[model samples]
Target: MFLIFDNFIFDLDGTIINSSKEVFQCFAMAFESVNYDIDKTRLNPDIIGPPLKEIIKLIAPELNDENKINLICQNFRQIYDNDENDCSELYDGILEFLKKLKKHNKKVFMATFKPMIPTIRLVNKFKLNDLFDDIYGIDKFGKHITKEEMIEDIISKYNLNREKTVMIGDAPTDVIAAKNTGIFGIGTLWGYGSDKTELKKNSNLCINNIKELDSNCEFERILK
Candidate 1:
């Protein structure tokens, strides 16, 4: 079962940067800026990976209309964009892992659903841009870049062999994206999209920590 992927595409949110604390803080700041006086502690958990507009609609269900959702979403961007000093930080051990992947000669890139603008900001804000060779993120859904498509784009962007590219994420969506392109999918247990049961279906395998990924290539080759 041993197989090796020469290229790897990764998800940003729960998979790499555990910015729950800062995200929560930013969500609260956004609403407060809009005169809503929202509490981040309560709203933070829901803001993990989805777009701010989606989170705004979920949190401010009372304002179900489109216009209000847009406004609140704008508020969110204001807060998230205002400061990078607090909103983005790589999860501990991430740098070590990325360096290892680089040393192994694996092409590494980020293929996240996170909008391109903020994704760029977050990477540079935290000085993570150097670790990745390419960054493929979409600004909006209807722009024709399906989340899954980003995986394909990254694989092709680097001219990677389909059998040698892996997509590592925390959601079932990640699995669909990877399989859509005949690539490998690896899930993380420390994220929001999975419990033990869901893990079995969505990924070729699941891992608990990035540090555990020291032996990841061996496991991925076998599992896939």
Candidate 2:
């Protein structure tokens, strides 16, 4: 069976791009710049899915000051965005899969928890602007929204039929957001952010390889 959806929403960090190395390094450097020491274990790939502030809170639970948190996030952006070497790369077969979607006239969008500035930068760097109908971040246009809200906004703004849409990501949050928005959720096992057990439990479907999503591959039907 081929499970097909006309509208596809993707998560960026762990899904479209493998950004763990750059993200973890910058996170550590950001805390150091702020004179705060974070448990190195807390900077692991598991923390890559959430918004920056939330991740900060998780890694440094002792810091309750909002101003300090904001400062840390700013420092992180400075370090990460200024890096000349692009450490991130699209997962193997991702580019081909995206191009296949576009070739099939599928409407594709990206909804990520990362802020808008870096999101746009990465998209432009990879020359992926033409692949998606639109891209969204947690702080798009200065309005902070959760992943669920972002999905809802995309659906409403584009008048997408919920039944014909699917969200593809590597985090449990991604599956939750899609379900909350009444859409199918497909989990990718190759990404860093998710634990295989939890992701498989929450997702409508799970695939171990990016190539599993290729246009010619057999897709297990999404159970509603």
Candidate 3:
């Protein structure tokens, strides 16, 4: 019997984890290390799921040079890396959700703007590395890697059919990425990017609860 959705591509950070605590702490550390104190609430510091370059540009518009961006990123990573796991925690029901997906024989993956190294670390640290066949993340240069690369990689990695894949995320980026790759995109309202201003506006489906993500969604433009 065929399943409703075969492959599940998940965006980390806000989608599966309530990582704001660790995120704010790391950013505060990063700024403090550079002697630049930051007020987390004032600066809107919970931007872990958005594209890094976009967040950087908004936060430090004065430092437009590549080198300065690199430095800030390095500092952030330096502080973020020391005890990266300190503030990171999986969202409620997330582990069970993964187990359910795996029980259904569906392929799961990570597709996020976070750099590959830390992303890998957190996954492994939380014992989630074994849950996915292909885990995708941003490179060290802070480039905005599209979800297409991730989808193509997963397809090539597992020989998957594009029609069988779906991207689950909170931000518009994830929705756009899925569409660009010719796959269906679903957004979660329980994330930082709730209500899909630009992301879910074009999404095929969306759910407020992660548990509501399976099998019951109304198909929009899917082709057989």
Report clashes for each candidate as comma-separated counts.
Answer: 1, 0, 1
Q: Candidates sorted by TM-score, descending order?
A: 2, 1, 3
Q: Which residue runs of candidate 3 sit more than 4 Å off their true CA positions?
A: 1-3, 43-46, 64-67, 140-144, 215-224
Q: Each candidate: RMSD to true structure?
A: 3.6, 3.4, 4.4
Between candidates 1 and 2, the one scoring higher on lDDT is 2
Clashes of 1: 1
- The TM-scores of all predictions, comma-separated, are 0.85, 0.91, 0.84
Best by lDDT: 2
**For model 2, how does the per-residue alpha-carbon lDDT over 1-224 read when each residue is reduced to its tens digit?**
47768899999988999998888888888999989877898878877787788889888889998998999989999998777786888899899888978877788999998888888889988999999999999888688888899899999999999988999999988998888999999998988754578888889998877767764332344323
CA lDDT, candidate 3, residue 111: 84
Candidate 3 clashes: the total is 1
Q: Cα lDDT for residue 45, model 3?
A: 32
Which candidate gets the maximum TM-score versus the true structure? 2
lDDT (0-100) at residue 203 of candidate 3?
A: 80
| C-alpha positional error of residue 70 in candidate 1 after TM-score superposition, expressed in Å | 0.5
lDDT of 1 by residue, 29-144 (tens): 66767677544445655446665666676566566567656776777677766664764567778788888777666778987777777778888777777789988776544463
lDDT of each: 0.71, 0.86, 0.72
Error of 1 at 149 (Å): 1.1
